[model samples]
Target: MLSKAFPRRMTVFVLVMLLVEFLDEFTFGVTETAWPFIRNELDLNYAQIGLLIGIPLFLANFIEPIFGLLADTPRRRLVMVGGGIMYGVALLWVASSQSYAMMMLALILLMPASGAFIGTAQASLMDHEPDRHDQNMARWTFAGSVGMVIGPLALGAFLLIGSGWRPLLVLIGGLMMLAAFIVWRLPANAALRSHASDADDAGEPEYGLMDNARLALGALKRPAIWRWLILLQFSDLMLDVLFSYLALYFVDVVGVGEAQAGLAVAVWSSVGLLGDFLLIPLLERIQGLAYLRISVVAELILYPAFLLVDDITLKLVILGIIGLFNAGWYAILSGKLYSALPGQSGIALTLGNVGGLFGSLIPALVGIVASHYGLQAAMWVMLAGPVVLFIGLPWRTDKPIKLEESAAK
Candidate 1:
């Protein structure tokens, strides 16, 4: 009875989980746009910016595994709830920061908090529909894309209102606090009867923290897990690493001001929003890996053209196309990681964090290149993302069964 009524019983559970992704990306969207302004106010240079971004990510890889281990425990709610509170607090700390060190300290705190809150929700979502990992990830990515669209636009709006990134972050932080309260208010009753109550999300945990950690680390030995994990990091060069540098590139190299730079980021994210929305349905008709083969090729061409274009308007157009091509990159790649480690989404999250420890340095590396050779020179490094994807992706993998065929059965 509970299994049959699960979706009905736990609609709120799914919604809350998706909302966490939204807030996480929303923070990114705003912060990514605010970087140029943040640099201006703080008088920061590229190397300093690199450290500000890299060190936190380096440390968070160590911290996030702890939370991933906690995801299946009796304390899952407390962990998530506390993570949400800290998420808000960390953002507020950024808003209050007066020095580069203070802001850096806040981001270091923010990353792990995000890993705990958002990572737990993502793992639960993957566990919720173990059989439809790609499909569910598409849905999750769509939710996040909406926030990505809202993020820069919200920052732009704040700038228009004589407020700025700091005030906008304050608003985003307050919303996180509200999200935490709602997380707290949900009663752990029959509500988790379906999607939420599945052993992945709400059942009594089967392993202690150390046991879970051991299992998660053990899974890393599988080539299947390593393949997706490595690809995930490499692909991110064009996805996130590219996005992080975009505003600065626009400001310094493209001859644009902060407002226009925000617009460029908005255009990138809005097209990504469209792509994410379209991908949810597209996944039904084609294999996720099949889609990746096509999209990666397209991005290989588009990303280079984006950097070479002399006109900002043409650059925006190219960026939108690149965003479109890369829409399902994270969704499909991560879904594969979960599939590779079946029944272990929490472990998959840990694996991703571990993998991230290396990729996290990519931005700082890019920043160093930009500082030495200039931002335009550094932009070319992003091309490595697609080049590796073209080489590393297995031409033949995934079960022979098509998703549409699986659905019919």
Candidate 2:
């Protein structure tokens, strides 16, 4: 029943979904770049700033499973469009917030919207090209890497002109709305409604909240799943948590100008973009887990060096290399995890979010430590992340659980 042009349409659909991912991470990247200014303007303490950053992810722990369930339903396109629009509105709310409580509230709304868009988009990608999970994920993350690079630069341009954070927020909001509109106008088949109907006819089970919960629990029971979840937690702590605070660290500790600090953040992302671009070729030759192991070990060496070095330029160079090695980790782990749970991609991703629940606490904990001992000391906490990742990753490769075989139970 599919048209001859379905492959082209699917490619276009994936590009649109990548744009959605771009907008989401771009917003977060802008937020990270703007954090120091926001902190100064609002007189926020480290703990409050941490709360601003961490609470949304903490809430997403619960919210992701709900969206994950929606991804399994016929309303997937609605979820993607509606969630993208809500995220845009939430960014406007963030722009208008005058208090820490208001900022936190805006972020809380932002997280679920993001979760809805992300869960559905990933599901749609897998649904369209079931055999190409690794390649598709690489493409997905590559788009996000490009966004992360551009986001800070865009914000930096605004900062250079003295337009400040509010205008940047407004700009990101507008982009998200535009992304939503594009998704809404996609054709019925592009939205994969026919695929959903076919699966329903084929007797694939409909997942209510209880069904989602059961699947999530079953996912948790698998050792491979939990190990990968733990690996994701540590990986996020190392890369994302570190990134969110990097600009602040540069401004507060390294005595850099604010715009320069934003540039530092941009450099990290730019190198990551390069690394992701290079990853496409490497993936063709290397196994995902093997690549992950090598990358993690490299981070073990470079992360400490970046933290300990006193020269600003040298440190920035080290950060760039760190981003290079950090490139394929999420794609690999995600591809492997999804492979282990073929039909249950939503639950698999939700289980990763469950790990994110605890991982989200690291920012707040680091904030508390920074408040007392300084950010330099707070950064030392990051050492544990890679160590945990290296130890916890399923290195042996023989233990992957086949969730599709037992998902009914």
Candidate 3:
């Protein structure tokens, strides 16, 4: 029987993980908020700034599978701590950067470290309590929601106190260090260690680079996984594109100041947290594919509303609703993806991250479109992505499968 304390400890671990995510996400938000300042200081153009922002995500996504493969090894905790240290150093480098090229190099190097830590942390949590997978995962998702809320707000508040970006970067670096310490302190499980040793004793074939590639390709070839991946990619694009530029859009296009824009973004993230909270219970009632279909339909309405409305207040309302709906989709889809590939959670998550990387490109592309064409044009282009998601709903083969049944199989 599971101890009552187990849930509490899991919650604490998840919160600690969220703190790490907050720091990681804060770097992006801080950079977004500080970009105008950095641009003026560095004499950078829009294209250069865009590259700086997009490159880290591109690198992180590309390297995630490699990290994922390493995560399946027995030394996950060590990898996580080392990755955290590297990420912290990278952030400090960014804080000290004096040139565009230097900043780019810092971000590219830091991203893989960050990606590794994220994969390790997630794998650790899932492996910690495999029996309580859904509940634990919900807790993890909740923590991420909290982090998303805090990251932008903290950046905005810190910027208000000091104009220079150094203070903000240093603050984030400190948080990352703290996260690394917590990760280091996580108790080792004898059962997990024994399981790994037993598996090794059995002389199971070691998975190499080719094996990893084949597993990823095998995952992609599944029609069910493919459908979910498509939906995930489209939805992620819509969300990432918004986050990457929402602050800028409000500040530059909507004539709002940095503080107000940051607040709006914070509200956007907060509402997403609320959405995830609501989703916890809702998930009990609906299948993963059902949630995906509903979310897609809701987004179709919300996406157009987001673009069509110009009122600042109305825009915030629309963004809040969108955030709430968006929260449910990822968790639910993640559950589905895990179901699609039983007994391979680590690789499944890595493949999902890869899908997310492809999804992230859509927003970067939107940024370029906005730069060349118009902001509204970029927004209009994104509408089609979600619409296509809805169109593909009929093709998905996902249905509710009881956890016990999945485990038995």
Per TM-score, the best of the predicted structures is 2
Candidate 1 lDDT (Cα, whole model)? Answer: 0.83
lDDT of each: 0.83, 0.80, 0.68
- The candidate with the higher TM-score, 2 or 3, is 2
lDDT of 3 by residue, 262-368 (tens): 77788887888897777776766765567767777888899789877889899888988888777765565555666665545566767877776766566567767
Candidate that would win on lDDT? 1
All candidates' TM-scores? 0.91, 0.92, 0.85
TM-score of 3: 0.85
How many clashes does the backbone of model 1 have? Answer: 1
Q: What is the C-alpha lDDT profile of model 1 across 1-409, one tens digit per residue? A: 8888668424777788789899889999999888888998999999899888888998999999888777755556677778899999999999999899899999999989988878887887776666788988998999999998999888888888899989889988999888878877776732122224544444434556887777776676566678888899999998888889888999899988877888888888999999999998899899988899999999988988888879878989999899999999999999988887665666678889999999999999998998999988999999998898899898766443322233245
Clashes of each: 1, 0, 0
How many clashes show up in model 2? 0
Query: Considering lDDT, which of the candidate structures 1 and 2 is the better prediction for this target?
Result: 1
What value does the lDDT take at residue 228 in candidate 1? Answer: 87
Q: Report the Cα lDDT for residue 70, model 1.
A: 75
